[model samples]
Target chain A: MSDTFLPVVAGHAEDGRVAPPSTPRNVPYQNGAPNPSAEALRAQFADAVQRVDVVWGETTVFVDRARVLEIVRWLHDDPTQQYDYLSDVTAVEYRDLDRPIEVVWHLRSLPHRRFLRLKTLLPKGQPLAVPSVWDVYKGADWLERECYDMFGIRFEGHPDLRRLLMWEQYKEGYPLRKDFPLRGRFSRSEQLRQILAQNPEAKYSMEELTVLEAFDELSLEQRNRLRSGEKVGE
Target chain B: MATTTRTIEVELSTTGLDAQGRPQRVPLATDEAGNLVPMTPAPALEPELEGEHMLINIGPQHPATHGVLRLVLELDGETVVRCVPHIGYLHCGFEKIGEYRQYNQIIPWTDREDYLNSPGNNVAFALGAERLFGIEITERCTVLRVIAMELSRLISHCVWLGTFCIDIGAFTPFLWIFQQRERVYTMLESWIGARLTTTLTRVGGMGADIPDGWTEDLANFIRTFPAVLDECNTMLTKNAIWVGRTVGLGAMSADEAINYGLSGPMLRASGVAYDVRKDFPYLDYETYDFDVPVGQTGDVYDRFLVRMEEMRQSIRILDQALKRLPDGPVNVDDHRVILPPKSKATSDMESMIHHFKQVMEGPRPPIGEAYVAVESPKGEKGYYMVSDGTSKPVRWRIRPPSFVNLSAIPKMVEGHLLSDVIAINASIDIVMGEIDR
Candidate 1:
């Protein structure tokens, strides 16, 4: 939403800097032909925000995290750019880069038939916090929570921020990050067993107890006592 | 069979009761006595006045709910005060799995995303990967892809209409729709090796040529579909009860619909003339002549009408595609990406080696990302894939239309009766496999 990120979509970058070469041969429409209204809106967004980077291949407008909520509010409330819908909220982990994660928000305006992509980059190991867009777009609540649950990026003002896919007692680190092992054998079913074992009051069947203790060295009486609801631990 | 009715007295539980002339337990008090007593509690319960509403969970297993979606519904009697959708019950970590498998290997997995529209999923992923690979498909391959996709669309819509009517208490329509759908599955089975999870499209082109007698059979199927659709529409479309249940129910404004990312029939029914095929033309969609239907009221009835009109339009597109069907190779001549035919691989040594290498070491796509969206039966099905100059994708994400469209349900049924929730959900045509994936 800044002046630096122009209305024109940036092409894919070749050398990883300064933007990619523009393929004008397949340009869907002529650029700078008849764009008085769009140009004015672009200038307005530029005046309101900080730096904007237009990635070439993917048309994204990178805005600072602090001003994202303000930008989204303007985009949704403003009659000229009423981007009322939040299509997606996803994050990418750039392990090779100095700033590791980039959160992307895809917004669409029905009346104008226009699409906008907003992005913010977070430093490595830093907890990225952005204002929740739930008040502006009701559909964004679940998506923002899912983003947090997967990428560990926090949405500070979310009404009910909780792990969506993972269980209530999952203690493992974020599973979708690049640092997580891809093919490692870690069973969530097993994790649930460990949790149940620690809580003596937790009711579980004998068949379930047997399945949980199969991987570990548990005596027959200890397993039976646990299944029969007897407190086995001191 | 005449019978006499008799009343029997039964004893209810008395475990929590105390011996007294009157009943012991009070509504909000711990004990039966008239005197108030403090209850052992943890979290504080917000005070609710008499006749105030509270939240109730409808699923993870309720019959009305689809798959494993759980809805937290706040209600005042039968009217819904607030609604929240809880998902991820069927999540299998597909996006994470994509990072480990090769590009071609992911095609089979996409079939499970929206199992009803497997070919559309295949084409969307193939198109995304093809864009990254910078490969152009052959004319025959494009036509074949359109044919497969359109057939899949018809089948998907049939399944939706069938199940929707069933939800509204009509069972016969489901059988009628399934009869039509079964024919489609049989046709696809003959073309592709598999019926449901048909990995027909490859990155650069189609996997195989059309089987013998396929065109004549397809034409026969198309000729008979319009009559069947008209018959079904006549039976249900004008029914007073059906209209009463659906018309002006679950209404969403055009602005609200778009803001919630509702696409496909939901957006079109909200009076938006936005279809990926028309707006963002992919494959040979630009060449096909079809109408983009729009609804006036953006209600459940409008959504149903849009889908019915869309089925007619799909038939029109199928007729044109059949007429424009080309005679040539289905697979592109990009030996680097396409595998050789099985017959040729056995006879020719050069063909045999190419097949081996193409299967083992998948084609390397340039390091970049591409997002390609297609108009499936439900809505906009977009595949966003990022390649890292390797056979496997670095990231693969699906923008499932059902998942995004289902987000609009709370707004649709905010003040509607509880029973209307089931009808609205049916009209939305959500597939839980796609939503939870």
Candidate 2:
């Protein structure tokens, strides 16, 4: 890449709002049919939907977390809506909001060629849970598990929900939370010990466990100590 | 009872054998509530009369698996009854890591996800970032992205064919295809520094302008590549062993494939003409003319045929892009986005400050999210970006096609023989790193 390739990641323009959506979003469509305007979705789920906002040339509806399951089921099952494909499911940590955690879903209708993004915010608490959409779409099986894996956002009725990337018994906090340390909260020594204990046949090395950046800060003796998994700092 | 006829009474447990060779119970995983819970399969109904059924653990490590993938197969006398795929072996927290790094930093990681098509991943990632930034790339950059992407597809498909041929006991094609792959890699290396991990694209444009005469070399390579493909077709496509092993095997209807989230050749082979390139055009793909190959029966043979045709289609795209290569600045000339050139930075006052701020703090985008899907070799390789008005994205989710497509394995493998598992798995064209990411 060149020096010319530095910025633009944050966007060229500072204005967050996109130019108004091409068509009037207030116009409502028939139920079970697509091209559902922000108003149509509101009309469909009058009580549940909080608001609909267009960001970056797409529609993102901030819906009620409590009735998320019912709204999602309707959106998928409604013949007109038929958002059969669950393209992705992810969690975004706002870090500042009361709930702070927002679960986002990208749903697509193959026949209709329409895309919809639905988001629900969760209140701060332990044992985070949401209704599983695995039944509605078999593809949601792993996506939901991953959401739980990274954000500790559980799916209420998921058939098999467990830690995906991390060890099941791992008690380290959810790794994707804004507050979660880039280098994990626990030392590599403890993490390595736990994984090795669980999987004896695994071929992991000390190189994977120790942070090379920290090694630069260490003296030769300390570096050697780290390589040997010895606690030299304390 | 005939059960005494040398048939071992075996029940396959979910866990692996311990040091003592005794089958061990799989450790139950904790739920969100920290309660130990097993992801056990529902009890299989007892047959009217018992028949043989056993479970086999394929790999967290195995040759047939493209990378580190573990598949637990419940088999009934050489027939797969159920397949439960256990991923995450190669999970490096790529999405989580994206939260800490800049947009450019994520492209290299994307390459590693599907190393077989590193440039394809590079362009797909850059496209996602570019859309989020609302910066329309130059004509030259768009053409370059298309060329790189198409070339990567050609290379990735070669790897897929070679590996699949090996799975089916055909070794000659494996050796033969590598020669073409080496030539393609050399061409890629000529312009970009690395061959395999080619992180060769910038957000607004490419890493560097195409090196002198790179296009002509590629055109020369493409001219000879088709004869090799025709040779492969004659050698393997109609061979008795190849036909017997692949034809009418691992077949699924279009609806079932879609419901199971299949895409790319696997989806197209099932008779669904759904191609992201045509359906959801990006990077001026609408201007290009190429046919999307579709197959009637979504069988292993059909998948094989579709991908072969796809290689031809990619060649066509490459030719078109090469013909229409534009002359202009590859990177957008936005001072806010792109940095000032070295020559300008040394001589100017404002340009120097712009460089310092951009190099240190990075750009501050207005908080927003963008989902961009590119027609990658495998399928719809999408990047979902959520920016919280910071240089780093709050949520950078990769919708890997292999991950979604792999979900259809059980549906395709069930009722097929143990040997057909390899054929079906190969047809899916999975890259484990992408799946596990």
Candidate 3:
């Protein structure tokens, strides 16, 4: 942060403080990065992450997938650089790349009034292996799973890596990816039927099967066996 | 090793083969006491157990859930061990659709995202798009925008308060508040063409000018709102049961609130005075006379109080906006931004051509990116627009308030009782459309 921007950033931090006396009513919009103090903070992140790149007008900091756990641990535990919260973790699918997908985590430090965007690109065809940030922020568990479910970018250390909004037996590829059809293959009722078919033996009687009546019924064991592609008997 | 092979005579029986050439049931192996037992399949090796807990699915359509927000909660009985919110059930892919639509055509999509505050949603998108076009809105347009936004804020809060009461098992307040909310919709309908999804405010101005005596009607509504708020405050704010259910429940420290990117009433309830309007004033908000209310304890009660107080402040702001109503052209004169009137378009050749161009291809924004944040009813509603010097925006992303505020749910309800989940959710005031969009 430069000298001029330091006071403005400091003013924002001070304003965030509980019951600050005489908060600055108006702060001029300082669009440029003018404070050297921010440089030191930026340097700390530059040393830790593998590479920081600005692509397509977005700032992204890349880190090794293997060292994600370490990076998040430091980000949350380090006192001066405490990013105690993981705001969002979303994945973007780039069809042009060899990996074709990247997971991005937006982290924030409330005390310092600072934020950082962390990115990790995984190679295609390789088993997804990124440590979970659930232990650090607690909020990342669901976000990471959502990202995993949407982009097929797995978080290796996630507690439960099941489909979130989509049903368990959904065969379609990740929806947020570029290739995924915006208008899905199935109709609304068909989608519901597919979801209901996942748990066939749950016993929805005729009266209960209002909208989802067309799908065939099977026992839970039978459904599970079929889903696993097992041959029942010769 | 040499094995002695014996030819055994066996009877081949095919009594119950299905049409698919598969047996319906196979003979089972016999266990000790002449009891037949089915052969057990081998279990897949499981991951190492970190800990054990119970799992519960809250909703795809459960009561107390604001919309179709489904939460997979790992619980230890009454206490929430962990929460996983599953969004996208209400996702219409608004951002993706916006890319294909014209600038004005996208306003209705904004209304559906944050349905409770349609006007605010409209203004946020309109302002961002207008800023990109470098269109200067006249004084009358700005004042009208402020009034509409503040009224929408009050309406939004009324919905929040009503639904929050319902979540807490108080049904009467919901009915009482909705009665008042109906009036707001009626008032808005008079100004705009539609009631719920108005799509009222255009990019550089409004779709239509305010009708006669609209200010008096708004003033009358504003005057009545305070009494209705008082009734709600008396009914819920001080009720012993209400206090017991909310006070100190799902509380978060100021640090945690900010770090989690929590904003709106949730952040303000945590004693942070970071209202985007007050911090980053826009649309003549700097001249508005109002107070930014903050709460002491960052709990459900504090959030409730903050929103209630905010409704009052919104009314105050609305009063000032109505008092300072200016007379001027509602839309900017720039033909590139706003379409000419129908009369002019039909009569004049130049107007016809300008209208034709604007309708066929949208206004081309400058080659740059800008983010504008507003203190929406829910929280900080920010619009990030990237234009490539084209008629259509390259990228349009909304930093939705409900989406960010919903991130604090698990942290807020971590160790709290399962019953309190509804209270915490109500405090967050999440709209699934906004969250999933």
Candidate 4:
């Protein structure tokens, strides 16, 4: 509706043909040419950008967690850079527990035909939180939620940032975290017990139940339980 | 009030014929203008109910949902006021699982996520792994991968077409198109030895090459598949029911589609013409000639048209790939990644040592990360692998396209009728395995 998406990007030949993009042959593990947007990003947000690394011909710019949202907004809104597409929002937790957790955002500039990776590292001692880019790209909604669900990272300012891959009532630790065991924290029998103990009527969230306006008609005990900010139905 | 005698002459032809195939000539009442009088004075209209919105839940397990995707709809009468989609029904934690498995060992898991496009997933993962390992695949392997990708795309789009038809109440096309899907599966079965979960690629090469005369079978399929597609195209492309159900429904502008990270047919249908193959080429897809069909309105019908044309273009690519497929080794000559031949390993001690090391410890990529995306039938399916100089990756991430595309459903379905939600959901072509993964 805002008319920001251009009809065509680079790589088009003058004869109305798409320029042939060949597969990279014998690409090195590191030190490939970085995306030009990385230079522009560093120039635009000098203090926010911590470092840039070109690995496997992909450019990764590590930015300060506090300024990630502002940098992303600039990347999306800036006409010359125009990284309008948010490909993925995921986090990487190294096997070494002492290493900081890295949150990665893969952004594609269709107008400029460039791909840039933005990362923000959260140290172990501090709370793992990053600003949400939902305002810039609505597609980041579920990606950020899944990141929160999997890695227990708080996406500040994401509306309805509940657990995505895991249910709201799931009690086990983040499944993708380094400390989480391969065979889950709870034993199989405990997992089964938890499943059976779940209230069927609690399938709909409290926000969803408000649509029916059936709160008043509920049992007094159930109403009181819901009023106490508990999510249980019985 | 019509106490006076009044006869209406209803046009018999307009009323349609009876069971006997003749026009029924029932007595009719006419006003002074010779117009047909109302039957029973037009039954009084039902009183409008206001101030109450109903809630409807469609499956975590409904047939129309295609898979385990649940949607909670708040409806103001039959019109949907809001739609809240709940996924994760089939979340098996493939990414978490990928962290434990070796790079080559993770191929089978990729097949299970997007089960319909398993081969394409295999090719994408292998490409990512190869990039991380800094290994260059063979010329023959490159063309073979192109064939596999296009064939996989064909199968996926065929399944989409069949299921989409069934979703919109057309039964014949589903059966017809599924017959074609089975043919492709049969071909894949011969090539990979498994039909559904074909772990068809390794780090540097394919699982196997085409058996003798297999290219002829592919050629035959490419030759005859279009006729079947043409038949199906005639059946559904301009059908009055299809046009009525799909046109102008769940439309997204190009700007919104790109901002939402849509790709493949979903993005192209919005008229952006941004295809991963054309824009970011892999597997030498640039060498093959094909057209990326684009649509104007980005509606359900445009998605349908884009997929149909994409299948035809895949045929063209397949035809070109078949001709250009060179004669050489399928796997790279690198012993670190590819294992030695069994005969050579049995005879030569050095070959045996190479095989033993590769099998025992697995191929380890350098401490780095690579994100490789392929234009899967659903969209841009990407595999982002991060290695800490280990055979197993530090983090393995799947950028599932349907997950992002389906994220926009709440925006697309809010203002439409409840029935159109099914049409719109089918248009998104989501595989819950991929979305929930």
Best by TM-score: 4
| Candidate 1 residue lDDT tens string, A157-211 | 8876766765433456676788877643367677667656553222222333332
Candidates ranked, most accurate by DockQ first: 4, 2, 1, 3
DockQ of 2: 0.14
- Each candidate's fnat: 0.18, 0.24, 0.08, 0.57
Best-first order by lDDT:
4, 2, 1, 3
How do the residues B128-185 of candidate 1 rate in per-residue lDDT, one tens digit apiece? 8877776777788888888888998999999888988888887777888789899889
Candidates 1 and 3 compared: the better one by DockQ is: 1
- Model 3: per-residue Cα lDDT over A80-114, one tens digit each: 76766555676654435464356667665545544
* Candidate 4, B1-437: lDDT as tens digits: 00112111223223334474333334446668887543344555856776588899999879989899999999998899999888888999899999999999999999999999999999999999999998989999999999999999999998899999999999998898899899989999999899999999999999999899899999999999998888887777655557667877898998999888888888888877778898888988777777777777788988998898889889999999999989999999999899888999999999999988888888888899999999999999899999999899999999999999999999899789999999999999999999998
Q: Which candidate has the highest DockQ of all?
A: 4
Clash count per candidate: 12, 5, 8, 4
- Ranked by TM-score, the better of candidates 1 and 2 is 2
Give the per-residue lDDT of model 2 (tens digit) for A166-192: 654466878888778887878999878
TM score of chain A per candidate: 0.62, 0.67, 0.64, 0.85
TM-score of chain B of each: 0.86, 0.88, 0.87, 0.90
Tell me which of candidates 3 and 4 scores higher on TM-score.
4
List candidate 4 segments past 4 Å from native.
Answer: A1-20, A214-234, B1-47
Error of 3 at B108 (Å): 1.1
Which residue runs of candidate 2 sit more than 4 Å off their true CA positions?
A1-37, A97-99, A200-234, B1-52
